[model samples]
Target: MITPTITSLLNAKAFESLVQSRRSVRKFDRSVSVPEEAIHRSLQCALLSPNSSNMQLWHFTWVKSPEVRARMVPLCLGQNAAKTASHLVVFQTRIDLWRRHARWNLEQTPPSSGSESDKRRMQLMRKYYSVLMPLAYRTDPFGLNTLVRKLGSFLLGLTRPVMRLGGRGWQRVLLHKSCGLAAQTFMLAMQAEGYDTCPMEGFDAVRVKKLLGLPAGSEICMIVAVGKGTPAGVYGDRKRLPLEDVVSIV
Candidate 1:
């Protein structure tokens, strides 16, 4: 076990303040351009966010060109966030790259020295990437993989707890969940860097994909507009349910 140090405690307080200061600012100060370094550093922080199985199926598209930003504004339904932002970041999930990532993870495993525990660990790592990952991500035209997953889950769950697996919908949800976590980390990092962000789900994903030239298996998670926020950008006082109302103790 580890104990929190004074520095860690202070950092926690700072993090709380940062979270409190963050807001979904719809209007940005166009006159004040966001530093390129800030966006770059924030994206780097986002890349370190926790993801399922470390597959890292996410991608970020930074729209800095004025022409592309202009094209994306209408794609985002002409939202003020897109219209005024100095930069727009598109978060995407590329489920199509799963196999490549899995193979990469396998390749990253180091060779074991002469030890039973080390050898067993290496074997488990290899099997996890080679066998389990393929089973989890593979699909077919006739829905055969989905059928097998459902049947296996039902049979195993009858005797012990098992993860219920499904078709493309489930896979998409898994990738999006990981991508959303990365997006949150990016927003927090931006806030720490004295910037504001608005995550917009209101957009024509089809058109945005075409504009960005994203492949078929790529899905847009959200479009985040970033810049210096104006006072008028915040809609109103932040509202949330009371802690007791939302939390439950067993």
Candidate 2:
């Protein structure tokens, strides 16, 4: 609510430079540190991300120490970008957070016979419980952890959504598109701040989660690093099939 009331919304053209400037920068000069405040600003932008129920389910871990970064680099498929970049962020989605937030919403009741503080507490409880219940229906978490896991694969179109290979469960693959959007938003923000960046999913999830001490029911969906790009930054070819190939009309 505190965000400014825009007299006009941003047109797609208004965001042209941001869209054009964003690139998966693979090389960086590692001598500098991304200002901690700028890192916070990048994460703060994600706070405004839209979620299934305003649960703000995304969490980010910033890796700043050299040894830790080296440990994580191998986990990320030996990508040196994770080491030398000024910022390395591991973005994750918390199904547990979603489930808990949802159940809390479903369990709320009217303010009981109590003081105003109790009444406020009850009101808050009701709000979250309401949000969570709907999400649970969409997620369908029954006692059938097996069934839920099985169904999650089907729903998410994964061979195994939570197989328990290492971290989290079997790990469904759908998060890249959703979480990738958040990472893209980060890259765009970084670019707008004159920072170059890269996102990597081509790594061992099991290893990276350990490096970050991620909680269970969470998975490292993507990694992003930011800094000034090398003069010979290896940018992939940018090509699109065409609007006719991808767009549709009602």
Best by lDDT: 1
Q: Root-mean-square deviation of each candidate, in angstroms?
A: 1.0, 7.8
Model 1 poorest ten-residue lDDT run: 105-114
Say what the RMSD of model 2 is: 7.8
lDDT of 2 by residue, 109-181 (tens): 5547889888887777775466423324344345454455456546666553443221223223333345666
Residue 15, candidate 1: C-alpha displacement in angstroms:
0.6
Against the hidden reference, what TM-scores do the models get?
0.97, 0.70
Q: After superposition, how far is residue 155 of candidate 2 from its true place, in Å?
A: 17
Q: Can you give the lDDT of residue 188 in candidate 1?
A: 99
Residue range 1-250, candidate 1, lDDT tens digits: 6899999999999999999999999999999999999999999999999998999998999999989999999999999999999999999999999999999998898888969999999989999999988888999999999999889899999999999988889999999999999999999999999999999999999999999999998999999999999999999999999999999999
Q: Which ten residues in a row have the lowest lDDT in candidate 2?
A: 163-172
